[model samples]
Target: MGFLAGLALLLLGLHLIGEGLSSVKGKRYLLARAFSRPGSLLLSGLLLGLLSGSGTGLSLLALGLLEGGIFSLGQAALLSLAATAGAGAWVGVVALAQREVAEVLLALGLPLFLFRGSRSGGLVLLGLGLLFLGFLEMGQGAKAFAPLLSLLNPGPWALYLVGIVLAFFLGTANGVAALALALMPFLGQGGSMALTLPLIHIRRGGQRGS
Candidate 1:
């Protein structure tokens, strides 16, 4: 985690922290408390979908917020599901678009606009920026290391599980997904993407419990 990756993680942390803090602050800031509403839930879900298009981090954040008493566990879980599903939807779109930066920016922009002017917005923006930059960095890094990605492309029935376990432990599904995508181009041309379903499902179930 260099400057960009660290920044993205930090921003994401701020968003969740702000949500929890805002809820804890109570009646003193009715405006801030508004984020706890149903609309906010939907927006948060969509934003989660857009950012990395992986619900793992969003779900974990929801769990943390719930634990902190920002939102009910049920609400947190529901939003997590929504966010994950939404991200899956966006992933399909991303695949079709074949333009990661454009797709990511579109996804993240909504939350920033919706959450703007609030205490959490500033940090969320920072995190979102970091995440976006990190995403670009990862993609560039992947392209630079094409031979390495090629070596990992061919599977031996273990890469799928390896990807999931690595993702879970690393706490960064983006990294896992990058590896998956890299391997995908070589997995019998159209087969690499097929593994994504099982891998994502595996990570999803484990992360929720975590």
Candidate 2:
């Protein structure tokens, strides 16, 4: 139930983010201008990935921008690379404090969402908060499977395959990473599995971008 709830929240958060971005005034023009320069595009992608904490989400966002004629293919590719890096960085920084950050975002976003002038910004913030909270809930729910995972001593190749499968189902590197971390202590080969999961998800994100 917790995992399912988390998945629902995660999807909802992504939806809200898309809605907020699409509704913002001059958003396309601002994005196009930012993507005009390689450095600025990379920075924008990194910041977006850090905020969204999902390379897959960034890849989809890039695709949407491409379809909207706001970005060239090359720019979109660059954005995906930078965004993946930023998402990895986010995992390292926020893995432990996700709940706190989510609470803070919720506190700030709710009031802003009620005001017409700041609706877009509010939606983005609320989406981010929900994303973080979803990750936390998923991690908690994953604890139930610890005993089952502990029974197997999987090799690196097996772990890689597992990571790929999990990434495919989760559709978000952040969620997979959270699950991996939750189950790490139970696995005898935790180190290799830990490294493989994020790499698999990153590859998946790259593929989606392409």
How many angstroms is residue 193 displaced in model 2 relative to the true structure, after the best TM-score fit?
Answer: 1.5
Name the candidate that leads on lDDT: 2
- Runs of candidate 1 with Cα error greater than 4 angstroms are 1-40, 48-78, 89-119, 149-153, 182-191, 194-198, 207-210
Compose the digit string of candidate 2's lDDT tens values, residues 45-154: 88877766666667777778888888889988888888878877766654564688899988998998999999988998898788778767766776676665566656
Q: What is the lDDT of residue 195 in candidate 2?
A: 42
Give a tens-digit lDDT track for model 1, residues 1-75. Answer: 243353354335335434533432344234226546777877767765664455766676676667777778777
Off by over 4 Å in 2: 1-15, 22-26, 34-38, 56-77, 151-162, 188-209
Q: Give per-model CA RMSD.
A: 6.8, 4.0
User: What is candidate 1's CA lDDT for residue 10?
Assistant: 31
Worst 10 residues of 2 by lDDT: 187-196
lDDT of model 1, residue 17: 33
Each prediction's TM-score versus the true structure? 0.53, 0.70
